[model samples]
Target chain A: MSRESVINWIVLAGLVAVPLWAHLSDEPFTITLATRAVILALAAVGLNIALGIGGLVSLGHAAFFGIGGYTMGILAHHAQTYTPVMEWPLLIEGTKSMPVIWGLSILFSALAAFLIGLLSLRTSGVYFIMITLAFGQMFYYFAISWAEYGGEDGLSIYVRNGFPGVNTLVPIQFYGLCLVALLIVLGFNAALARAPFGLALGAARQVPARVRAVGLDPYRLQLLAFTLSGAITGLAGALFADLNRFVSPTMFSWQLSGELIVFIIIGGVARLFGPVIGAVLFVVLEHWLGGLSDYWHIYLGLMLLGIVLFGRGGVIGMVAGRERSHD
Target chain B: MDLILLAEQILNGLQFGIMLFLMAAGLTLIFGVMGLINLAHGSLYMIGAFCAAAVAGWTGSFTLGLIAALAGAAAAGALIELVVIRRLYDKDHLDQVLATFALILIASEGTRWVFGSFPLFLDIPEALSGPVMLPGGIQYPLYRLALIGAGLGVAAGLFLLIARTRIGIQIRAGENDREMIAALGVDIDRLYTFVFALGAALAGLAGALVGAIQSVQVGMGEPVLILAFVVIVIGGIGSIKGALVGALLVGLTDTLGKIALPGLFGLFLDPAQATQVGSALASMAIYVLMAMVLIWRPTGLYGVRA
Candidate 1:
């Protein structure tokens, strides 16, 4: 079809083929790396909905990511210890079922996003960026001090959470599950991009006055996008925690949020497979350059600077040319 | 419970706020004039602390070390502005943020590579080391008191420079209209470099002053940077007066909440639970304050209505 779509297909094929090749060759580390990239890409895709589509530059997606991780951590922690999550109002039992945890994670994160968006959406531009960051820091500090759930030291689960008929303990199986999640989300993203809501949201970003002139509520549209964005990211977070078999306050750190943005930027902002390309490149570079020196971040910084300065539309842009349409 | 302890905490809050003002003022000025968000401002703070520590250790003169800090950070700031930040002036906040973020990674890793992992320590000078007796027999660290005086003095100096000097007029003019000032024959590039260095110097001074109280370490600037961001947001971006008020408000809220919240909670809850909950809420107090401020006045207390 189009050059960009061709590239997207090839990228998707490579993501699946690499992990399968690693599994066949008994290279578990590569599979783990692939899994990490997939999870991170999923998180960035969530961000892409707000950022690329709605033009909302949020520096606080980590809050939802952490919420998802902690959801998994708190529930699975209780499941492992056989303790009820709460007993004050009503008994809430901890669950190790991936489906349940995912649902709760999505629900909680969406609720949090709705509240945060209600407040944050009141501001725009640089204020929006700083406010979202402050919100992230708020969650981070709360996580660190809420000592009941392991606090700063974090919580570790001995066994991985279960998905039906899938031995997730095997790295490849887990990677496949993440890939499926990514693919499903990507499909949704593509559909949403073409949908009327997406069109209105895109309009709201470019010209709020015009969006209002057409009787559409820009704020409500953005808030909905932000909420959905948080839900998907929350799902990725649950998956990420399960992959690591641990959850920590570090998940909420501003650095993680920054890295998520970096993934979007590196892959090609608003491109369908941009996050996928960006995340894989980031993981590969991190693995490759990390082995070269302890101070590999210096090189990473230099590369990022070069990209921002000269490389306008990132890797996808360089290869596929400019995007066909603004949406 | 004790009035003296409360008074001392208030003083500590003031000192902290004033130091934060040093950081925020520079940040606000740069943002107001250039419309650039420099995430690496904190890295300049770290550089100042490191330079001060290294020089103080070598020359056995704290004053000289402070001077070295000022010069080093200014030079670094000017160099960065000339090389990287200069290109970003016309870019969007996203590009500005990413580029400056890259600078932070480079500065931090480069500092770690050169200084190694261990934190460098700067000692309080002999003259400012001991406690000073104040009104009502309150004893406070001379160094901290000096920090308050110095921060205020710098604040005053900044106000004067902006209010009275020839460059001050130009700076104020530039903030309102950049192209007009350039068209009026002002050397806009040099002025920008000068302003960036001035902001850098202020941050460096804060770093050097605070470095004595805490360990001079890499990544230390980030937390302070975030706090400074909160201050600017609360004060309304691009306003010096807003930065001052916002900085003090954050500092007081943070410091007082840490102590008062626990005591308040302890009145109702068990001591351990009170402490945990109080401390947690205390940590979040400033953010809550920021949120409330935004709700009340989206443009900030002193910000001109957008």
Candidate 2:
């Protein structure tokens, strides 16, 4: 393996090993923190496929993220209340099955992404960013005003949903579930990055005219990337809601979207495991500094400024060295 | 709707739209001239309101407070441009966004550090506190009328300044060709700083004026910032006239939709369901409107294809 690959392996091992050690040491709280890092990493990784590779600076990925959370929230809420989700064409009851939720999360978020992407792909750069944000705001307002599913107050699932064999109430079992999901997604990401679609998406971002010269429509490529990105993020969101056993409108907030972008930037944009490293770093900082001072965000802001100003390569870029080429 | 109520809502919409214009004009000018998206722009608005509120509290003069807001925001703008924004011109949008997002964090926290977490209050002047009679015997808040009037006056003045003066000529020239303007011996750096400061002052004025009607506090600028973004997007980035038109449409649509949507729902649904659905959908109307506008004109109504 190359030096960068070595670093990636070390980072991946550390991510799994550290949590395992914590779980063995009976530090469930630490495991919870790791779970958070994994979940957020998954979400940010989804964004990286679009933003870093596809050159789509989406400011509204939280809509997809929220879609995931709400899907889980709605299903679990309805299941607890023993109410059917729909009764019109055919009766459909809310389910607490993990596999079913994951499947539906992917479908719902993918469909939402497709519709959102259809409109947003027409514009590029700043217009694209603002339109994405607007759509997110629309979803946010919709959630806040839709009182049936707890509205502004949010929904809660008293019991963790069932997976095939695991007792998800066990902190380590649940953490393991999330970690497996994250690893599978990470593997998929790595494969996708090396695939033909990745090459085309990267080209579309760097030089759309050239890509068009070669006869591939950049818009369609971007839309596909967006849809896939939204789907992965939506899956992460479902996992996150399961981890927390609650969901809120705050998931759709622009701040969450911005933070996701921050993760990718800090970890190293376009890198496969960038968000994994970034999420770990973020959770560590949030936990440690949060204990020390209430004004930790100021420090975060300052650190981000320093990174943007002085550290272009981020952690992986700094340690593993820069990639050979990019726009 | 009653004619009187409709007229009142229209005026309210105008006032809101004008406030948005003040914010959007500054934002578009900066984008056009600098090719930078300063997320910290809203923080400057917050600073303006905070300065006005604090100064008004200390001096007991709303006029003095407004002056402080203008000076405060301009000074903040100039400093940020010199220290932070000047470096971002050649960088890509991602860098600009990250740097500016950092500035937002620093600005917000710093404001909280100085002002404390509690919201500050700013009272309207005694003279403009009451309502004024319009042509159709409609009553409106004098302060709001003055706000509308002030916004329009500033809009006109800004248009004239951009179109008429020597500096205006240079600004327009710089927008068209920065390299040529600099080659012609114009100080590009100073001009940029001036433009940024001018935009800041406008945003600050909006904040100060609105602060009187709403609570002045940290993060107050953020919602308005997003709304302003929506306005500029609808108007077309970098076009002042687009900003104006976009602002009016958004403002009127928002205000009127809030009223009309619920009533429309009431026609078909029960009172409770109508209220819930109407308010929810009304909140989403502007975004839907933006989507439609973009579908019709992808670059926005007045955006130059770049």
Off by over 4 Å in 1: none
Q: Give the interface RMSD of each candidate.
A: 0.8, 1.0
TM-score of chain B of 1: 0.99
- Score each candidate by Cα lDDT: 0.93, 0.91
TM-score of chain A, cand. 2? 0.98
Candidate 2 has which clashing residue pairs, if any? none
| True-vs-predicted CA distance for residue B283, candidate 2, Å | 0.5
Docking class of 2: medium
Pick by DockQ: which candidate is best? 1
lDDT of candidate model 2 versus the reference: 0.91
Put down candidate 2 lDDT per residue, A133-218, tens digits, no spaces: 77887899899989998899999999999999999999888888998998998888888877888899999998899999999999
